[model samples]
Structure formats: structure tokens, C-alpha cells
Target: MQLIKIDKTQNYIINTGTIAGDMEGTSGGPTNPGPLSIYLEEGRIAAITGTKDDPYRFKQPNRQTTFLDLGSLTILPPLADCHVHLALDGLDFATARRRWEQPGELHTQISTQLWDTVRHGILAVRDGGDRPGIALRYRELVASGELTGPVIRASGWALRKPRKYGSFLGRGVPAEMLDSALGQLARHGVDQIKVLVSGVVSFKEYSRVGPVQYTYEELSAIVQGARNLGLGVMAHASSDEAVALAVKAGVNTVEHGYFLSRDTLKLMAEKQVAWIPTVVPVAAQLTSLHPAPNQDNYVIAKTVDRQLAMINEARNLGVTLGVGTDSGASGVRHGYSYRQELALYRQAGLTPEEIIRCATINSARVLGLNWGRIAPGNPAAMIAVSGDPLGDINNLRNIEYVFQPV
Candidate 1:
């Protein structure tokens, strides 16, 4: 206990043993599910159990103890966001672009965004990319304890081929400069690599999309280059052809797979590449742009339905999936967006447990971190809601408070 730097005079215990969420064992496997008590030792969970009526009364040599009764709250793992752009304020394209030009303002906005995200119970975030190394800087700030926020996994700057709409919040690295660009991110110590293979869907032209940025071979080279530097690749792909091409190149995950076909999804499953549907961006945008069932809203709604069906199909076919709200996209607010994403997944046929698992466990897996789940010996990064989130997914919004990096 002294080595862990926990207060030796008092043993801290959190009890009343309300509930145990998804992961539940020391071996990193599931255990019996029920109300459980967790003891805090050295800022980590020393003991966790559901059977005992008096959980805080544990034997400890030469130690005084204090207990925190959880009462009726639900105990669950910390949530993770698989994709985001801290640089964008999630308002509109023009506002987003203007913010980039004002560096001082941009940094302040990032601080606000990070604070809001973590305060909302998101413990870890994978920033897809942002300019001027803001994402990496924020990650450093979090690591150094200068800022109290989530563990940031940054891609530095997303890569793309030279073309229009290619460098929205990322850099477009030419084919010849692929190795050098990857080296730069590696030098900055990025957690992963993001490369754009296609553009965002155009609201004005409902049937079309942003132009394809990289061919299959080009994307493959970027993947290989990043892998050489010990980084996995995630691609921003939305069209059918672009999604197929990205999967063929062996990117680790595909973002916003809006128009993916069954065959392409099967291919992704075969290759073990996960998909982040990012359904809330569209939902948020559609509601913001045109509340009624206007032509644009109708078209986007239809597309959203198709994408949700494909995601449902992906689950049935055993394709791995991670959830993200694409927070910071147009009209997709950060703190509240993830709840919307979870609701959309539930509407698309995922159970509340499954949706919560995607936001916590599966998202962590995609980010390649050991930060989720409530297991003894694991860090006590957890959240307590006002009610059982498993019973009603909407209760996730009722997060009373969160404790993380425990």
C-alpha cells in the first residue's frame, strides 16, 4: 500500500456493492454478474466482490479504513471514444475553418472540448487527426497532468492524397512523402495513424460523396509505411468502392462506412478490421440542417437507414465494431453526442449491454489500450449512473459522476 502511494493511515473502500459491469475478473475475463464492492488500494482496485453484505470490513495489517457507500448507483467501466477531432467545434464547416486560423482560440476550444468529454464519463479518446499538432499537445498535457482529461490516442495528422477536400483536419501526404510523413508522426509519438481514402458526404448533392483521395495501392503503401513505424492504420472511408479499397489495403479500421455493401463487410470481417459507423453525425446534421422531412433530410435519413442495416448485418456476420459519435463534426456536440450514438446503435438492433460494451470495451480494444472494464487488479476507471443503464440505455445520460485513472 505504501509503494502504491495510497494513504497508509486510512484504507479507502467503495461499497454498498451496487453492480458489476461487463468485464469482471483478474484474468481479464468475465465473471458472475451482480452487485459488487470494490476496495481501492494504491489508486487501483485491490478487491472486488458481489456476495458480501459487509464488503468494506476487510482484513488489513496495521491499517485504518474509510468507506464510501455507493448506495443505489450502478458501477460500470469507463467509456472510450474511438474517433474525434478536438480541433473542430462541431458547428459548421466555415466556423471550423475559421477556428483553425486563430491558434489561441483553437487551443482554448480544445481545452473546453477535452474537459467536456472527460466530464461526461469518457475516459479515453482516439483523436483521428488535427493540424498544428494540437491533438498530440493535448495528449502530452494529459500525460504530464497539466490538464485533467482523457488518455488521448492521437494520429497527429491524418494522411491523404493531394486533392480537394482532402485535408479538412489532416495532412495530404504525397505518395513519395509517405515514409517521411509517417516518420514525422512516429517522431511525435502518435498512438496510431489515420489516412483518408474518401471524403465526407456532400449535403448539397445527396447522391454523391467527397472524391476518393487515395487508390488501393496508395492506401496500402501508407499502411505499410505506418506499420514499419509500429503504428496501426485507420482510414476515413465512406463510399462502397472506397470502403472496399481501404479494406483491401488492410487498414486497421474503417470510419463512417456509410455505403458499405455486404460483400465489403464480409471482407472486413475476414480481415478482422472493425468499423465505426458514426451514425450521430448524420442524425445531428440532418436535424440541424432541416428538421422536417425535406428533400435533403429525407435523402440523408434513407442513407442512415441503409448504413444502420449494414451495421446490424455486420454484427450478425461476426464483424467486430467500435462505436464513435464523430464528435466535432458539423452539429455533433461532444459531451452529449455519444449518448446519441449509443441510442442509434440500439435502434439498429444492438442491446443496451452491447451498446455500452461497444462504447467501453470494444472502443478500448480498437484504441489498443487496457483501460476499460471493472476487474480486480485493473485500474478503477469507472462511472456511476443514477440508475441501471443496462435496464434502460437512456439512463447513460444520467451519469452522476465519474472516477478514472484510478
Candidate 2:
């Protein structure tokens, strides 16, 4: 990896973990005290000390490299998008496959998506799942430096009960055949396991709660199976029972818990399971893609409002929430929906620092990565924004640039 240094004279390094009144302070900004020294070596932070000018003044290990000055730029650890679909944004699986039928076409699409994510300052992404080969192929390309994108940790394909939610892209086999399916996915080198427990309301079919995809027994089996193989499980559950089952089954993350109850939220907090509300898909479906007709918009709007209410309750109860844009649904677009998620989180009553932490440190922890902080030995995945996001959360949408380890 090539070494690069960004120097700023007047910029303040606000610590998000501190309990300061305002985000900015007197060290340089209006609220928080700033760090005095920050050093990077081999893509990891070598040192970070309190306000002491020239903390590394005595150390003279290497002076052969040059430093790149980024005047007046505030640097922070790279952001993480906890929930996203690399293969299925707006367009369906059939369309994506047709567009990438020829060799290198799929590679190009992956490259564009990855670069777009980096441009938006997202350094790590947890791709829920896609068709078998797509995610694995892209992961290989990214690792080989053949692509410019965030560090990807992907589930090869989701596993759902036959004829259930996302069955097309998931391995919807019988319970008797699940072991074989998991074995196949492991051979394909998946980073995690994705299980679909309930149907999404955004999809026209089964929108109004009817049949859940997996039983508690089935979920437990799959969870145990994945754990035995040393893989984590991410579940797509929207209803109360489904979320409960997923939690009971020992799933690590729950996606789109729209109808989660207060008890369920408490259980999640107790179990330390991370939640990704994915409010964008539900909101976009009602407003942009499938708008309500006639005078019934009010009723439909209330349903969306109810989902947000559940999220708010979860937050108040101390559930670990992460950033997720259920991108690639019929109407949602990838790379842009994340901003909507941030806005929704704020609307659900989270402070600016809380919201940023959800997208950065919290999301990274959910994905089991050690690269979210700017401390020593972490990956040099960092983003620089024009304004302090602690004061205004919307500044996240206006990311200036992103740098990922080469």
C-alpha cells in the first residue's frame, strides 16, 4: 500500500465518543476539544495523542516519504453501509444478468457501483446477498485490485423457504436439502449467511402479513449450521413473530424490523443483535414508486408512519441500530438511498453523532470488521467532508472524497 499524509493547520478533530455539549469545541471548532497529533503508518493509525504540538517530534523512524497536505479538511474514519444489495438495486435479477451476460460487463457494473459508494464516502459495505456468482465474482475483483469500491463482505445468496420472500435469489430448497445448499454456498466462499424469515411489504405479493418463510425450528437449524461453519447469519424479518424467531435462533443482525414490538426490542438489546430498519424502501414505495390512488393516500401514509414509530421505540429502548438502505428493490436506487436512511434516522430522534456512529462504528461492529475507527492498525479507509457532520447530519450526503487502502 502506498503511504499518504493529509495535513491541516486549523482543522479540529472532534471525538465522537466524547460526551461534549456541542459537537465542535474551542480547540478549533465551537464545541469539542480537538486532538493534537495523528499519525498513520502502513494504512493504520500509528499514534493519536492529546493536544501537544509535535507529539512525534522525537521519533525519527523514516523521513523518506512525502506528505500530502489537505488544508482545512476534517478527517474521520470511513463510513460503513450495513445493509445493501450489490446485485439487485432498482433493476431485477433478470435485467442485471442480461446486462452483464458478456464477460467483463458484470465486472464493469461492479466497478461502477463500488466507485460510486466510495465517492459517497462509504468505505465498507455488507452486501446482504445476490445470485450465487455475482457477489463472489465482485469480491474477488475487489480483493485483486481490479475494482475500485468499498471493502465488501458478502453473503453469496440468501436462503429462504420455498416460495417465500426473495426466493428467486435465495436458495429456496426444502429443509431436508438445506444442508446441501449451505455446503454448496460454503464451497463458493460466502462471507456470511442470509436467511429470509418474512415477506417484505414493498413487494406486491404477501405485503399484508400472511405466511412467514421459516419456522422457529428451521431458523434454529440454519443458524446453528452457519455457526458450526464459523459464518454469521443476517435475517430479513419484518413481523413480530419472525423477528422473535430470528432472535431466538441466534441471528447476528435483523433487517427491516418494521413491526417489531417493545418486548422484541428489549430482547434484541439483551442479545446484542443489531437492527437495520431500512426505512427508505417503505417510504419510497409509498411515495415514489407505488403511490396511493384517490383519497386513500392518508391510510397508506399512516402505515409507513407506523413503521417509523417502531424504529423510534427501538431507539429509545437502546437497540443497536445500524445504517441500511434496502437498495435494489423495485423502485429504490443504490448509492443514493443511504442518505434517505440517514434523514429517517434523524427524524426517528437520533442526534447527529448518534446517526454518524450508526453508519460508522456501529455498522462495522455488526459486520464483524475491525476497520471502522481511525486508531492504529485499522485499515486506512477514511473520508473527508466539507463540514462537521456532528452539527448537521445532512453533510453526510455531500461527501467530498473517500480514500480506501490500495
Candidate 3:
């Protein structure tokens, strides 16, 4: 088991026991009927050949090709985390925030988390914005090879209302200064626009979330402004009212859509808006290493159950779902918490295939990438797991190799 950075200039042929295709319109079965010989050229999948037709044809060693024969490993599209806060370390928030003043310490912390994230088979992550634009800075570093990490789609700084829930996450954009604020963010070269539609959900109070921060008009203006700049909006919305507002306003994705009603889910389906139900962050509160004494465990557990039920309902109603561990939030660690998020999806009654689809395909779509599939012309960014992920979703945790293109 190793993490291999693929050299695009070199040719390689990997022979694997099974190769799973994207779970799009049909069943998520292996692309080939039997053992597969996959050809990679210049960082793209050149071809896929099944050994059932001619086993010995590609088995012969050649000088020009780097051959790898994975006996039992299964290859599939690499995973993605749609909503993460790279500035937070899932530990003490006070300590992590204080390090923000020290650039050297902050970079060191973020570098370590990025490696942990990629090692867990997550190749891409969408940073859920930080106030100081720390994640945005790291995105450039990763691009220039100064920092080693996943593909980061960063929201430079989130837009929020004055005295709202997300002071630490981003700047407060007043209604009058909305255009000026967006201009500043666009000039900063943000990959997307993050708007705090509502505040955080409550831990002690069941079914209680913070008030919606933006009116429908304000939110719609933000969404349209972002679109004019060629960016998508990832709305930080909770409760049903906020979720509905974001959907009607044309947000690309809704993060932590807790307490969503059936009608809202139906509306999301109708509008084709993706939902990133960050269940792990809430679930982690109940079992955190450093738990808050004032938190109510029963209330948090019930809240988690309700969210999972909504996730199930969202899938049933054909709402696009993506896997997002609110990493850096209290009790949710990067890289490691991804498996926990998928497990929650399973508890929501999603089968292994469905969970994989959300974690890979749907998440990749949210990140504006053409990945999450292995075929001719697709980028050779895939992962090999020790066991069949289709059989048991936990097998994704056993990442044998990460086939990352250089």
C-alpha cells in the first residue's frame, strides 16, 4: 500500500483485479467484466482491456511501460470532501485561530492536514472559507508545488451580514456594499463564492438552528453577482427556511442543510441544487475528545438522526447529494473523518454504491471537476482499495494506493 504520484510523461499499464466505473445512469459495476489492464498515457486513461478476452496479451513485460499488477486491489475514482475548513484543525478552536497570526505555524498545520486528507483517498476538497483567507492562500501554494495537498476550490472570504453567525469565517457584507465586496473577492481570484445564508445549528436545542441571515433578494443578488463573475455559490445554510431560500436563489450547493422538510428537498430536486449534508460535524459533538460541558448529548444525537433521515429523503427525491466532513470544526478531523461521514450516509439507509456515488461523482460535480470516472480521456486520478467498496463502504478506508496525476 502506497501513495503514488503518477508521472504523466511516462507510460504505465496497471493490471487490477477489478475496476469500478462511475455510478451515473446505470449500475455501478466494474467497467470490465473481469480482471482489467488499464493504459495511462500523458495523465489520461488511454484504454481499458479486460483479461477475460486475452489474459497473456498485456501480461508480457515491455521496456517502454511501467507495469503494476495489483492482485486484489479495486480501482475507482478518488474521493472528494465538498465542504471543509482547512484553517481549523478539529481540535481547540481558540488555539487554531490564534495560530492564524503566525503564518509559519499555520502553514505547517495546514500542510500536515493536506497530506492526511490525500492519504485517506480524498483527492479534492472545497474549502468552506475562512475569515483571513488562509485557505485561499494555501490553494495557490498547492498549485505552485510549495504545498502538497488536494485540488482546492477555495472561497476567498465568505459574505455574511453584520453581527451574524460567521464573524470568524468571513467578513460582513452590508446590503449597500454588496457590489463592492464582490468586486474585492473577484479581484482576489476566488474559485467560488461562499455566502452564509444562516447561522449554525444549535447543539443543546433540538430542531433549532440560527436565523437566516439574508433575505431572498439579498441572497439572490449574491448568487447572480457570483454568476456574473463566473463563479458558483456554496451557501452555508441550515434549517428548512434557509435551505429553501438558497435553492430559490440559485445557489449551486447547500452546506449543512439540517432540519430540511420534504417540500424543501423536493424543491432542491426540482431546481437540481446539490446538498452537502455535513452530518459528521454534528455527530462528532456527541463523541468529541474535548466535549463541551454544556452540550446536551441526547439532543445532539436526536438532531443527527433527523438529519440522516433527511439525507435519505433527499436521495429518494432525486436530490444530488455530496459527502462533506466539516473538517476543522470541533471534533471533525481532516482525512480521517471522511469515512465517518460515509458511515453516517449508510445509517441514512444508503447502500454502498449510493454512498460511493455521492462521495465521488456528486462531490466532484460540486467542485466543478470532470473527474469521478475512469474512462478514455479522463484524468488518471483514482484510488485503489484493499477490498471491494461496492461490497462494504468501510473498505474505502483501506486505501491501498492513490493514483494521483502529476
Point to the candidate with the largest lDDT. Answer: 3
Most TM-score-accurate candidate: 3
- For candidate 3, write residues 1-406 as lDDT tens digits: 4887777667788888877765774534534444788888777787787765543332324436688988878888999999999999998899999999998899889999999999999999999999999999999998887877899999988999999999889998899899889989999999999999999888888888888998999999999998999989999998889999999999999999999899999999999999999999999988887888779999999999999999999989999999999999999999999999999999999999899889888899899888888777899899998877898999998898998887
Model 2's alpha-carbon lDDT is 0.70
Q: Distance (Å) between predicted and true CA of 382, model 1?
A: 0.5
- Predictions in order: lDDT: 0.77, 0.70, 0.89
Candidates in descending lDDT order: 3, 1, 2
Instruction: Give the alpha carbon lDDT tens digit for every residue of 67-184 in model 1.
Output: 6676777777778999988877786657767877888887788788887887788888898887666788889888887876788898888887776465666776788888888898
Candidate 2 residue lDDT tens string, 80-164: 8877777764645467657556656765666777776777777778888875557667878887877767778888888987766
Model 1 superposed RMSD (Cα): 4.0
Better of 2 and 3 by lDDT: 3
List of clashing residue pairs for candidate 3: none
RMSD of each candidate relative to the true structure: 4.0, 5.0, 2.3
Would you give me the overall lDDT of model 1?
Answer: 0.77
Question: Which of candidates 2 and 3 reaches a greater TM-score?
Answer: 3
Model 1: worst 10 consecutive residues (lDDT sum): 1-10
Ranking of predictions according to TM-score? 3, 1, 2
Model 1 CA deviation exceeding 4 Å by range: 1-11, 23-35, 51-66, 101-103, 205-207, 289-295
